[model samples]
Target: MPTILCQLEAVLRFLSNDPGDPNMQACRDGLRQAIAALKRHIQAGSSR
Candidate 1:
């Protein structure tokens, strides 16, 4: 969905920043969550 893509873009932007920064961990977590949610959405959509 558009919302998930937007969130993914935001996470990518955060990752594009300093990789050594402490906030990178938070960004990585967010990206993981977003990817998982996106996968769920896709699976649900496909099953319907």
Candidate 2:
């Protein structure tokens, strides 16, 4: 899981740093939501 998160974090960082296009706002929003959801899931798992 940690390894996966590390790799994923790199991608997330790239996405976050990107100056996204206005036309892709919906896709960016969806990615943000998905990242948040994954964070919540990770937090929940770690709390156990």
Candidate 3:
């Protein structure tokens, strides 16, 4: 699986060039999920 930062970077690049594109929203949503998952993973690790 790709890292959250990589996913976010891809999404950012897509949006930067085509902010109004419909696929841009999809990419953004994917990035959001990736970031949320990464955060959860970090929090879980820190609590241990």
Candidate 4:
């Protein structure tokens, strides 16, 4: 199964190699939103 953390890492690696890419910031923001959503889920689970 694909995880947000894994995808974020891949995005970071790709961006680092191609910093001039036009879609960089948007891609990064989307991945960050995914990660944030996952974090919210984790926090909720732990609070239970």
Q: If both were scored by lDDT, which would come out higher, candidate 1 or candidate 4?
A: 1
Ranking by TM-score: 3, 4, 2, 1
| Per-candidate TM-score against the hidden true structure | 0.58, 0.59, 0.63, 0.59
Over 1-48, each residue of candidate 2 has an lDDT whose tens digit, in order, gives 567666766675666665666645655677677777888899999999
Question: Scored by Cα lDDT, where does model 3 land?
Answer: 0.73
Q: Which residue pairs collide in model 4, if any?
A: none
Report the lDDT of model 1 for residue 17. Answer: 78
Candidate 1's error at 41, in angstroms?
A: 0.2
lDDT (Cα, tens digit) per residue for candidate 4, span 1-48: 247667777776676676666687777677677777877787888899
User: What overall lDDT goes with each candidate model?
Assistant: 0.77, 0.70, 0.73, 0.72
Model 2 per-residue lDDT at 13: 65
Clashing pairs in 3: none
RMSD of each: 2.6, 2.7, 3.6, 3.2
- In the range 1-48, model 1's lDDT, one tens digit per residue, is 567677787767768677787788777877877787887888898899
Per lDDT, the best of the predicted structures is 1
What 10-residue stretch in candidate 4 is worst by lDDT?
A: 1-10
Question: Which candidate gets the maximum TM-score versus the true structure?
Answer: 3
Which parts of model 2 are misplaced by more than 4 Å? 1-22
lDDT of 4: 0.72
